[model samples]
Target: MTSSSRRVVVAINPAASFGLGSEVGPALVTTLRGLGHEVTSLTEPDFAQLLDATRAALREKPDALVVGGGDGMVNLGVTALEGTRIPLGIVPSGTGNDMARGLSIPIGDTEAAITALTAALHRPPRVIDAGRIAFDGGRARFACILAAGFDALVNERANRMRWPRGRSRYTIALLIELARLRPIEYRLTLDGVEHVERALLVAVANNLSFGGGMKVAPDASLDDGLFDVVLVRPLGRLAFLRIYPRVFAGTHVTDSRVVVHRAREVRIEAAGVVAYADGERIAPLPVDIHMQEGSLRVLA
Candidate 1:
């Protein structure tokens, strides 16, 4: 085989975007194999099985590991290739392709995204910081934001619901969570300095966006050994509605109620709050996060 060709393993999520982009996985594998790379394609019945398959594939030491799906698939890749030198490649086929968006990867345009991936494979992979969360049960790695407040509650509720599928489920869950919104009293320790505060949401971000392009931390740096920790202070329902829309455009940071903190290590403590990283639930509050500088190699 030519030196330019790579031995690649592609893991795909069939439920990506609720099957809207089911064609992406097959296309990616075919394209890579056509480009003279040896491709091992893995498509499992569920997320857990797919993760297992991907981990097993990684044991063979592929040149690159590519994931076809949204941010959750990216989370799977993060854990599978953790502490390895192998680069992670992404095909944005999932609901929240925030990780791809943060890296300037083409979104919703399958051909363009594939072209970008192929080109990146030839060049050196980009190195970025990765966040590791250590909880009681286990530790998980993430390439994007960690939600430990109102946003995470919505994600938790939505994941538990079985009916009314697609993005609408998230909408319904948001309404439910919004109705139950209240300020959380948090004891945060950032780089060993402790502070107690009340906030509606606390997002610790390694990259820019989460929850479908909501730029909660627009100034987040990928290579820096720091987290752009965002805190949305307590607000009434009407005020929250006004600020919520601004987050999509990242204008929320301009408001007096929103605050951003940079920290390399963060200990988040809020009673009864579950944290979500890269769209996957990590654990309840009291999770410790460490920003590992240049810990992730990505084909972007």
Candidate 2:
């Protein structure tokens, strides 16, 4: 899999890394070029244009596509390279590097992360599953988690606020959302079997973590041909507050109110609820999702 001169396309979210970390994009490009790779670096003003530029670059059939950002950028990669054999590489420089964490790629340290990308390029790309989301307007792919519940609300709220940058924004959002928390009623069909449940949130996870290192589905696997359907039943504010901190260590899954199920295909419905996958707002439920085995090839 190693090449003396590989072509790489790098698309970065300029807003990534809280505005200070955009330098990682140029760092990656420089390092990649130093390694004897032909790199096409693209930095766009917004997500749509970034995705469009990435797609256009991907159309060139480069040796690889390296995106410098968080899981949202990973989502862009899957959307652009869906059904293609091209392997995607990640250079984490965002608020929540859950995707990179799940793949064991270094975070924060640009040098270490780029080193990992370079090493992965020299070996056979790892094959992983992607969750394909089908909602009104369109269908997209998620390489990490797709959640609809209280967490998604927090995501929406956080996106609206501009103060207190970095992970603290999400923390503040979570606190604000928790103050107004109410269990959502959900009708879920897993592998064609249906059930109704009331819970704080329902997360369909392909990777292990989300919302920054919260191991929402600690037992989940990226390559598994199934999704871990996690349901957190209604809890009092006190209980929820206590359990929230445990999610970082992934111990929240063991709580009695928490339940996990496995399915290859899922249909989730909750009136007035919006879903977010890989930290990007997807759509209002109900959305149909299924695990596509080995759908994505990643340079991890």
Candidate 3:
């Protein structure tokens, strides 16, 4: 869709990023309208409500769909728009705008993002890869990243916190969970190779980062047609403390305790495990993850 002819529908999550959604809604709509695009703003009622609103918005057959919230909101919109021709534009307003940061989108700066969106609308769409998680006849959607074990626990805790927005909340949650966390035994099959280990976390990436700025899979690429599987193997509490800082700098990949592999598909199995995609729980272990090539045409 081109700039002059495109129609836009902006979906707002009024409770995202610790309630910053209410503040960003008006600013984004005003900017898009000022740019002369036909704009409609829809408030997301809840996770379930988002899917229907997204389908309804897509039925309008707009040139582009704009998501005005954080990663979870983006995930909901993407799930609704997957396998369709419409491209997605994101205005990051979540606690951890991981996907937006990975795509180099300007988060929290509505004016700059709107200007960028205007420019992006005129350019050819960029085809990016997205990942899928499947288990027990059920599947959930995500585009950025998926993780299990310690990282998933951290996400669960962060979701429940009532204060301390953004990265600080995540940091506090991680620290709080550190005391009682235990490594779980698991088996990972990547491509065709099989391995078993006690692990702290297993992260599969379609993009580079998660938890705000931590480069859990630093070498991951959105269009590479491959996913980076990173496993943080069992480590003592002191060792975990020593290596945790390196994750933010993305230098932890070189450590022996951390194993990184590239594969087109992977399967993970563990007992009583927690799993998360983007930031939402999809299933337990024994899950299959694979990349969908050229599945999304995103406004970068």
Candidate 4:
């Protein structure tokens, strides 16, 4: 869409990135408006309210929906605009802007991200695959990783923390969760084939990175129409710690305990495990996750 004809809605979660949204959200509005595009800026008290407001904004059939938060916010946009004509854009204003990292959007640099978004607006939206998780009564859309086991627990713990704000809080929470790490028994069905394994974590990745550039599925692709099923088998605490750092570089996939499978659908069954997608709680285990190619149109 061209600048003059573009009707853009920029939704900001004020609490995201430890309150970075309060500034970045308005800047995005100014930048888009200054470019002569019609822009609507929105901010809400929390994610649920933001989701509702974003859905309302989508009803207007805006040319694009720009989100000013991390992957969780992008996931919210995926929910609101996936399979619709509206293309989603990212501002990467969150603690773990993993979705931006996966999309190669500038992270922690607001100006660069804005510049990228503006440039992308002048071109066609990039079509990419999206993940869906269906449970007993509901389903959710994710643009990045869907994780269960240890890391999901870390996400759970971090969500409950109110002190020591910002990334350090997640560091503290991660160390705490790591101390309690143990093998989890999971029954996984990949593309209809069943397997039972005791693992520390399993990630169904639609993109290459999550957890702030951790290459959980380093070889994964958004247009491949498949999920990279990453499984980390049980390992000793020290060994797991040794491999943990390798995940940042994506070399951990070479470990003997690490197994990568490519599939179009996955069914996960594990006791007492909660699933987290795009760093937000999705639901409990026993969920069916599948991939849909070209399900999302993204601006860069």
Best by lDDT: 1
Q: For model 3, where is the 10-residue window of minimal lDDT? A: 14-23
Model 4 agreement with the true structure over 128-240: per-residue lDDT tens digits: 99988999789998989999989998878888899887788889998998898899999999999999999999999998888888999999999999999999999988998
lDDT of each: 0.92, 0.90, 0.84, 0.89
Top-TM-score structure, candidate number? 1
Worst window of 10 by summed lDDT in candidate 2: 13-22
Ranking by TM-score: 1, 2, 4, 3
lDDT of 2: 0.90
Clashes of each: 0, 0, 0, 0
TM of each candidate vs. truth: 0.97, 0.95, 0.91, 0.94
Model 3, 152-240: lDDT tens digits are 88878888898997678988998888987789898999987898989898998998988778999999999999999899988889999
Model 3, residue 140: what's the lDDT?
74
Candidate 4: global Cα-lDDT?
0.89
lDDT of 2 by residue, 28-144 (tens): 999998888999989888999888888888889998999888888888988998979999999998878899999999988989999999989878999999988999999888989
Candidate with the larger TM-score of 1 and 3: 1
Candidate 4 — which pairs collide? Answer: none
